[model samples]
Target: MTLVLKPLAEQVMVITGASSGIGLVAAKLAAARGAKVVLVARNDASLTEAVEAIRAAGGDAISAVADVGDIAAVRAAAAKAVGHYGRIDTWVNDAGSAIYAKLVDTPLDEHQRLFQTNYFGVVHGALTAIPYLRDTGGAIITVGSIASDLPSPILSAYAASKHAVKGFVDALRMELTADAVPIAITLIKPAGIDTPIAQHAANHVDGEALIPAPVYDPALVAEAILDAAEHVRRDITVGGAGRLQVLLGTHFPALLDRLAGVMIPAMSDKTRPKTESTTLFEPEQRGQERSGVQPGRKTSVYTAAERHPIALRSIALAGIAGATLLAFRRSRTRK
Candidate 1:
């Protein structure tokens, strides 16, 4: 069955993790485009600030203070959105947390807590949004990571949770399709976007935690999520470099395994001392998009190409033809 989603102007969007990072960015963007936004997060102050900011910008927004990991809380958030806006046309599962530690070094309880926020939070958000989305053929966009495709050295638990997220999202998509559900499900696999997540992650290492190099602006991810809201996309990767890394990991697992020695240490910011700034068990009050670690790239050619595959193919075909013509002329001249 074909799924038709309403435009952002006419939709009511419920976004988890909307107090900061990509979720907040998306909520602001959606509100600007005339969608009524319901921002959900554990930090009431941040959520209220975000909602007010949107309102001050002449956009419609409301705050829902709830943890995405709790199914009942998630359900209540959904009900609140429906109660306020009359319907939920889109739901974005963007709440996530990470740990900067190896599997052996990280505590088992830490791993479970990370899963509660990352994996099961997605589970709760998706299940809670399904019935609402089914009503009017809306979209559910989950913010996963490139870690869903490639495993990281120090972030083993975070990677595992992302892997689980991808698995569950894929299976749920298939099941929904088989049952002829009109809800569009999209998995957004972002590379290291310049978000506060790295700084907020539970640090098991001695050094300050950091997202790997080739970090992208969180706006790119927000764009992808908003695009998936109006359009049906199975999955999207934000950065070209991260996409290349995933490809390398897929094709040369042994090579990535061998590179772990260098990769493990590089994932940390050695220049700074480690601080106890973690939101693994509880929420932090800080709300910002970029982590200010490094400047993030403003655009991604690969992501644009992925969004417009036909145009990408046309460019490829033209390049091939031009190369073939040049070769023919060179051969003729040589003869």
Candidate 2:
């Protein structure tokens, strides 16, 4: 069998959501680690800024503005990446959107929107990259929220989207392997990082705000994402909070689910509103709409992000759910 190890220096990585948050930071780190980068995002301004920063730091990079939710745009960006780098070594589906509303209160349109961005967006990336990855023997990495494993009433749609991503990515991984393709896929699940996601959250029910615990910097999650992609791990869960959730979910699912079901509601009842409509992704990325709710000030991690919150419940749910998974694995190992 011919061996094709990734060329760390000459390799190219296509990162969606590169205009901000994990996508932005992943591009920075990959370039630093010696990969030429192809950046994709909906915001042209942020894409320009991100590419300039990468070049300034002596990294090879190119930018393409696209809405991953829109299949055509995503396909066009993928084609551009192959043209720019001549070969793509990695693709990271890091684009995401989150809006809050009780499942019933949130309208169908909003849920559909989230589905387009979170679930179908990943599907689009997969469709675009699979053929290229097959040819290049490369990889695909998708961003999934802790919501996939944990349940939350208010962010039900957001969670559903992530849940769908996991199934999609996992199945894709199996198919690639079974077909004897030298391709790897990873799922990145990080606790809240202080990004603009929350401020941009659309209101579904009442204008309730989600006050997060202290969150970490977006750069933190970015590092973990690179780790997963480079190492070809199954899933990488970051933060003390996220670990806890995975643990409980693994071992004590019923208990963790009950507890989480109670906590989010109690928190939402006391939470305040932003008093305005905001966008999570930068304006250039989210159709040139100015992003409000300043960069998160979260600087701490309490089992989850400790410095700030993306959504009040995004981080905590991971810990609660993770625990059950952990516990179950422990029991199986002991057996």
Candidate 3:
């Protein structure tokens, strides 16, 4: 068995939204493991801080302040990574936003911005990485969500955006395989990690945030992401609940479709009333940045429903097993 591990010294990692949350944690882990990292995010200051922190910890890394919304900027960032490191081994499409509101309350450009980062940003990164990455069997990892797996009307746009990301990554994975490209694509689904994403969710005119979210730990997701990079698994679930949702949704597709309508509303305790706006990452509010890792929370475990893996094998197995058991029981009764 030939196990080809990504060489930490030669492997260069490019991460989006490295200024915070899972991206930040993932950067730390990669650096600790001896990979040269390139940090990309809108906040140049925060990106600098992350780079310095990593360097202080005896890790090699660089920072690029770029927004995923701009293809030129994304491409430039990718170029910059290769320039510094001479080669890029892994590229992660993690720049995304959840700032959303009711469909009726959504802005005309809401979907545009979502795709700018969520879908198009990934496309841009993938395109940028292709030329330089083709020879290295590089990996593309995108942080997806449970919302993508199971769409909900309340956050339809966010879910839709994620669904699009899933589609792109899935198709790209196969295309790369069929073409015999060494690059591996992985779609990472995270149920919820208590990142400041909710704080950054777009708000309406009434001070009410545009989207609501649940909490999940960022570190666990970071670990899972690194694991994916190492193993090149097609996809991974970041939470237990996420895993369950993928499982139940597959085994009982119709039932899940029906249940989602009844279940999605429970994700948030409150919804927007009137045109009020809410806090989302602008700071001085619920969206304040997390400076250091919190104590005792390095292990935020998710329920089965939250880790909605993009890979459907487990869900398929469960469906097949259930069907077989049901058929056996019916045959026995008839006999």
- Between candidates 1 and 2, the one scoring higher on lDDT is 1
Model 1, span 196-308: residue lDDT tens: 88888989887788888888999999989988998899999999999999999999999999999999988898789976878788886478877877668989998887777
Model 3 misplaced stretches (Cα beyond 4 Å): 1-5, 205-214, 250-335
Worst 10 residues of 3 by lDDT: 279-288
**What is the lDDT of every predicted structure here?**
0.90, 0.72, 0.71
Q: Which candidate is the best by TM-score?
A: 1
C-alpha lDDT (0 to 100) for residue 315 of candidate 3: 72
- The sequence of per-residue lDDT tens digits that candidate 2 reaches over residues 37-152 is 99998778778887888899998899998888888999899889888778888889988888777787777777887888889889999898888878668778888867667665
Better of 2 and 3 by lDDT: 2
Better of 1 and 3 by TM-score: 1
Residue 243, candidate 3: alpha-carbon lDDT: 65
Q: Report clashes for each candidate as comma-separated counts.
A: 0, 51, 34
In candidate 2, clashing pairs total 51
Positional deviation of 72 in candidate 3, in angstroms? 1.0
Q: After TM-score superposition, what is the CA distance of residue 208 in candidate 1 from its true location, in Å? A: 1.4
TM-score of 1: 0.95
